[model samples]
Target: MVVDDHPVVRDGVALLLRGEPSLVVVGAAESGRTALERAPGLRPDLVLLDLRLPDMLAPEVVAGLRTGCPQAKVVVFTAHGDHHGVQAALDAGAHGALLKDAAATDLVAALRRVLRGERVSDPRMVPGTAGNQAALARSGLTRREYEVLRLAAQGRTNPEIAESTGLARNTVKTYLQSALHKLGARNRVEAIGKASEAGLL
Candidate 1:
């Protein structure tokens, strides 16, 4: 099954897989709820799931697929490789996570590996491979702190970050302060620079 909210992406993936002799696109769904509801009946061998859906996040979708179709492997196919939701989905038992920007051959290879029971993550999304998770760990920054720092790096003010994240202004400030201290930076500007250098932003 292929699950993505965008019609073009959903159909495009399905079309691509149909061309591969080793694979079959059994079903396509535009949302997590629809995918879960249809998965049992479809009985697909694997699912290509988007990380963000209008109705649910990646982790929730992965959990539902696990329960509803335990026989099928779940692989997250997303554009937001750096989003914390990707990690959450992987932790929730997704077999693999591949970035949408990957070449078609790479995507097919990764999917084949997952179908053979191997866990795969895009190199850019992997910890030490891209210095993402390693940098995050070395800095001792929590997921929230990393998220806030990322937003700050994007030139968002504290209030804007709070509004975008649905967090209180003070909470955003505290997260930024913690992130700054962990990165050994004196202010947001320095923090952003250090994070960029470490590949954490």
Candidate 2:
């Protein structure tokens, strides 16, 4: 089964898998609700899921799949590897998480590994990577804080960051402040510099 909100992505993945002699694309769903509802009947050995759906997040979907299809393995396929939702989904019992930009061969291999009972994560999404580790481990910045800081690095003001992220101006300010403190920077410029040096930009 493949679950993604985008028609192109969902169909594209299904088509790709169909070309594999050892794999079969049993079903495709455009939302988490649809996937959860159909998973039991489909009885797939593995589910390739996207992190963000219109109705639910990856963690919620992962939990549902775990309960509804305990025999099946769940792997998150997403573009936002840096999103906190990736870790949340893994923590909620996803067998693996792979970035959408991964090569087709790598994606297939990762899925196979998960089906064989191995836990996998994209190297870029791993906590030990410089940028990701700095934000998640060393600095302890949340996804929102990192996002706000990245925007600030791009010279975006608080209002711009808020508008882009759909967060309130004050909320954006708070995130920036939190990021600055975590990075041990006194201001946005210093924060940006430190983050850039740490490969967090």
Candidate 3:
């Protein structure tokens, strides 16, 4: 199954996959609600889902599909490079995620890998490879630290972050300090730049 808001994308994917002897284009949907409504009935082996559907968020759509069709594998197909969306979708039980710009061979390989009970994430989006891990270790920020940096990247002050996160001012400061140290940044601005480059913001 193909679930994307754009019909051209959907048609392109369906048409592309239809040429493969081992694959079938079972059903297509333009919104999360429609996908959920039709998924169980289609009983597709795999669903190539887009991150930005008109009716629902990516994580919510992933979770809904998991609940609605436990047997089907869900793979996120996104054009954006926001790691938050990728992380959220994975956390919500998506089998894998593929960038929209990925090659045709990579797309087929990702789908097959997911069907075989493997988890695949584009390295550019969620780098979990050895080199990426080494870099991450040098600046290994926790989820809380990432959250703080994300807010800081938007020019939020400690008090603003505290208020937004319901954390105390001192706690926000602590998180910011930790993040800065991990990213080898002496100040908030540098930290934001490093985090953005690392795809953590």
Candidate 4:
């Protein structure tokens, strides 16, 4: 599946995906709404989602899609460099994410890795990977998801998140869900506090 607002980008990526024998260009759409609408029926093994769809944020899109397609893997493709956005994608339950400008081979490899049941978090462009769980508890969190939680704690809205990130709004929601579940919180506010208590934010 390819969920991007841009036809050229979507088609280009589709062309690339078609080349891999293990991969398939299952579906393509210009918006998250359309992606969600079609994805359930397509039963795609992987979703190559874009960060700039016209409806719903990418994180939210990822979350919704997961509920609709529990077995499908999601891979976020975007040019946004905000580490928090990358984390948010992971938090949203995305199997992987990559900068849109990343090498084509990188995207292919990421897809393969995610489909193989690997968790692929983008390394922070900075010095440390902070999203991993704090050592005090028997907990686990990818470094990227932690970044999403920290930013959500800082009070950024989904669109504000888009401005600050390379991720789409739905992808951010996915991160929120992952964080909330990990913290055993019922909502974002509680998730924030719990993550803070765990030194996750």
Which number leads on TM-score?
1
Local accuracy of candidate 4 as per-residue lDDT tens digits, 1-201: 888898898888877777788887877878888888899999999998886577777889899999998889998877664645455667888887777777778788888889899966556322134444343244465554565766777788867765575677888778768867877899989888777676554
List runs of model 3 lying over 4 Å from the truth.
127-201
TM-score of each: 0.79, 0.77, 0.71, 0.63
lDDT of 3 by residue, 19-126 (tens): 788888899999999999999999988989998888898899889888999899899898864445767788888888889999888888888888899998887664
- Would you list the clashing residue pairs of candidate 2? none
Weakest 10 consecutive residues, lDDT, candidate 3?
126-135
Segments of candidate 1 deviating more than 4 angstroms: 126-140, 150-170, 193-201
Q: What would the per-residue lDDT of candidate 2 be over residues 1-201, giving only the tens digit for each residue? A: 999999899888877777687788899898999999999999999999998899998899999999998898999998876566788898899988898988888888888899889988998763325446544666688867887787787788888777666688999989988899888999989998898777676
Q: In model 1, which range of ten residues has the least summed lDDT?
A: 124-133
Give the poorly placed runs of model 2, Cα more than 4 Å off.
126-169, 181-189, 196-201
Q: Candidate 2: minimum summed lDDT over ten consecutive residues — where?
A: 126-135
Cα deviation at 139, candidate 3, in Å, is 4.4
**How many clashing pairs per prediction, in order?**
0, 0, 0, 21
Native-referenced Cα lDDT, model 1:
0.86
User: How big is the positional error of residue 7 in model 2, measured in Å on the Cα after superposition?
Assistant: 1.8
